[model samples]
Target: MDPRARPFRSVLYIPGSKERALEKAKTLPVDAIIFDLEDAVAVEEKPAARSLLTETLKAGGYGPRFKIVRVNGLDTEWGRKDVQAMAFAGADAVLLPKVEKTAQLDELSEMLPGMPLWAMMETPRGILNADALAAHPRLEGFVMGTNDLAKELGCRFRPDRLAMMSSLTHCLLAARAHGVVAVDGVYNAFKDEEGLMAECEQGRDLGFDGKTLIHPAQVPTANAAFAPSEEEIDLARRQIAAFEEAEKNGQGVAVVDGRIVENLHIVTARETLAKAAAIAQLEAST
Candidate 1:
């Protein structure tokens, strides 16, 4: 499957140090998993987490879901060893935290060579240089680190995320400009289903490929929010039918439900149908 066409609606982050969490992930319906070896692990657990995660990844029960391993920063004590261990650990990509520029990705690429790199767009410098980072040859995706970003900017949390709009949209623009997958940051309040759904919908509206989730319960919400709705699918089908009929009649535009449907609308409509098909295939696989 094309990486860009693959559904990434729910990307769950699991602590690398936990055996139970790692095993449970194989059974989860999430579209992707971020096996985290950074903030999720304690200082004492870092080494053990690295070794355990490496072995777990090598074991490879994770089927079609994309596997991304989030490593500690190179500035950290365990980062180098973590990279060396996971270089061939069977993950689909390596996620580096707080990537500020292409040089960081260059350094990581040297260590892992051909590995696909995902950036954590958390810090101010990182957000500002999102274009440069997304343009890196090894970059495959961008994961928003909203908690760290909020702390870095000294911004208060709001349900609507008014303070986060600029940064979120900037990263999204960069990701879209370079054709990389962009995932929204975790919602934090895992227990609030309504809040999670609302945020998921907001992220989807903002053109994020998916929302990073904190817990298993959040998976279904993210998947449902990001997938094309029944109404959208119906409209896409109608639009295509109308547009084709218009073309047969030598017309440049077709009207669907009192609205103009043109070539661009057909393109978007096709993409929606394709996404719905991709989601169905993914669901069937796992």
Candidate 2:
């Protein structure tokens, strides 16, 4: 499936060191899971977590959710080993944190060969060089790291996220320009459903493919926010019908709800229905 078309409405991150969390994730309705061996795993526990996570993945029963293993930087001792294990552990992709350069991707690409790689857009340098990082051949997706970015900028967090829009927008643009999926970062307060929904809606409107989740509670909200609504699906159907009828009648446009519906509108209309259908198919499988 095209990365753009994939239903990544909710990509949950689970700490690899936590067996209970990993097991609990099996029952979640999330679209993707990022099994973390990076910051989520402590310095001393990295090796054990790597081994345990690999074994858990090997005993696979994750079903339809895309499985991603997040590895530490290549400079870290556990990173290469993590990649080696994940390559054969049935993961869909390996995620790299704080990726700022294309060369980092190149090095991993050479090492992993055919593995799909997802980049974490966290550092200022990562956002600045997003185009270059996204342009890497093996790069398939970009996940924003908002907390790290906030720390890097020394900015106060606001519900509106006004301080980070430029960086976020640039990273998103780079991902889209490079034809890769872009997922927004997590909303820190897992218990704050209202806040999470608002952020998910904002991210969807801002052209993100989905949001990276920190908790299972956030999954359904993100999924609902990103998926095409019933109203949108219904309108898309009408628009497509009207446009097709107009085309048959040798007209360049169609009238729907007293508004002009052209080929451009029909294109988006079709996309809406397609996305809705894709979501349905995914849910059915899940």
The number of the candidate with the highest lDDT is 1
For every model in order, what is the number of clashing pairs? 0, 0
Model 2, residue pairs in steric clash: none
What would the per-residue lDDT of candidate 1 be over residues 74-101, giving only the tens digit for each residue? Answer: 9998989989998889999999999998
Model 2 agreement with the true structure over 193-276: per-residue lDDT tens digits: 999999999999999989999989899899999999888988999999999999999999999999999989988998888889
Per-residue lDDT, model 1, residue 24, is 98
The TM-score between candidate 1 and the true structure equals 0.98
- In terms of lDDT, the poorest run of 10 residues in model 2 is 1-10
Error of 2 at 229 (Å): 0.4
Off by over 4 Å in 2: none
Backbone clash pairs for candidate 1 read: none
